[model samples]
Target: MGNFATLQPGGRPLVRFYLAFMLWFVGRAIQAAALVDPNVRKEFNDLPDDFSFSLGAAFNGPQMAIGKDSNGKVKYLGKNSNIVPQVKITIKSMEALFLLFTFRESTPVANSRERMTVEGNLSHACACVRILDIVQVYLLPKPIAKLAIKRYPKWSLKKHTINRLLINLRAIIGF
Candidate 1:
């Protein structure tokens, strides 16, 4: 019957395990803190109003499909066919910031005309502008809006252009 102190090997492993666990825990805490810092949130919120974002480097492919008949028959429509795709972009404004994203082809269209028409209609629709991470889109707080205007004196600050700004910001930030 040896005393526990005499069992040196077991105590060393336990101490090492505790130290490793503490190091891992500390590393995770630091990472989380960096992500949720108030300054980071504020910086994101304060991004330039003209910022825009795109899905990828290349231009998005044209979305197309075959025409459908009233009888639910598959119509083999050729390119520039009756069927076309729709894309929608939505921007929501949070406190001193704007968040923008896109929803595509949410609506069904019978032909290219309908698709083009819908797109045209949406072009004028204020909601269709695609700025991402806007602190405030509509009725922005006077100061914040003013700050944005000051940042981009020449730009229209429209949704489309704003989205482009956001896309660029995302790229610059590497986020």
Candidate 2:
């Protein structure tokens, strides 16, 4: 009988690490955007005061959580902890997460491609997606951000520049 071999199953550690970092930044950026942008603030405010969310790769992968704090301000809750978020957005696998973090696919695109899934209230998930789109616009450069979102906003110079800078600063400083 001829001999046959099977390849080993595997995981992408580097991709997982990258995803963890990106998720951390994105969580912080969302919180910061709510503080710096009136539109973002309004969107967040519309959510239930206790609203929280988690985004990450599926099956015990690196994840980040964000939600409103006691003062009703948005806060990055760090990695998943005791708090159970109202919405959880999970990417199907490490490859899909890599694609997402690398900007190879936008959130909407990934959803349409069936590479991602959401659990919880549909309306809240829609709001979270909108928040993410706006945060991505601030966090990434114009050309790349354009690729990351469905429709780019027509922002005034002050908003695109000043608010972007403030959001980046706040997110980085853990404000």
Candidate 3:
């Protein structure tokens, strides 16, 4: 009792334990929120379904030939020289939208295993739509572009992410 202020031998260990427990609890809570938020799920479901394109096809456009000149100077190429195929995805219902969103979020494109699963799901879902096509595209990173190109001969340089929901307001009703 006389030296209680300076005799807390186990106080530091207890404090550390409490902090660790709190952090773990908070992390788990955040993960749970990400998994169950209705708004997040709805946002994910609003992605398109009928659209499809390939990166390799984009590279095949004439733009690739318009590089720097022999003197190492950039050159401007004509507008018609580059032609990229446009993909238009159409969603018939809310259920289809949800399915697409789940597949995209769960399977990250960079991971081989995840990519395979996502591609499989996309293919399956595309079959349900009258005019949907699932096109395979290779991911190209800037730093490892050469290595990627060497590894996958047909890979393209363009990369894209599904960041927005392209919903046809006219087609969709209250949900």
Candidate 4:
């Protein structure tokens, strides 16, 4: 329906499309959570204004943009472009990335296993992992989240319901 990674008759584009989709999927989940979850949003708020981060893989591999919008909200900067991010997180391979998203692996575990690498401040990297962990709780259901994260928050029913509703709305509305 759109050039939003519309399929092309090539293997490379196909892989790129898949990676882009995954990045968008995961990014939205994290961004939406950051908007509604005070702790997660606070992490971004504490960063320098316009702090930028990029995630990608090896040579000529798919890359995704993530940055603070003018309002200091964490948002996806979309497909890879010229924006130079202060931090870059690169995975060893698509398979490794897939494992992380699929909940077969966690970020710290992946780092220890040498599946991913980061070039930037260690504290920022840790913060990113924390945000991603919260995203996992919202994005993946209980069964998967339990497997992916070392600790899942035990939210009260009332708080959980309202947070879920707001997170989904903000995600769709692109706040």
Model 3, stretches more than 4 Å misplaced?
Answer: 1-11, 39-175
Per residue, candidate 1 scores C-alpha lDDT tens digits across 18-95 of 433432332222222223333323332343332221110111222222222443222223223333323222111110
Which candidate's TM-score is highest?
Answer: 2
Which has the greatest lDDT? 2
**Cα lDDT of model 2 by residue, 1-175, tens digit:** 2588787878778878888899999999998998899988988888998889888888788899988876779989999667999999888987888887788888889989999889999899999899999999999999999878889999999888999999999989988
Name the lDDT value of residue 80 in candidate 3.
33
In candidate 3, position 76 carries an lDDT of 21
Candidate 3 C-alpha error for residue 118, in Å: 35
Per-residue accuracy of model 4 over 52-126 as CA lDDT, tens digit each = 787777665677767887788787777665788877889998777767766788777888899888888878877
lDDT of each: 0.27, 0.88, 0.25, 0.76
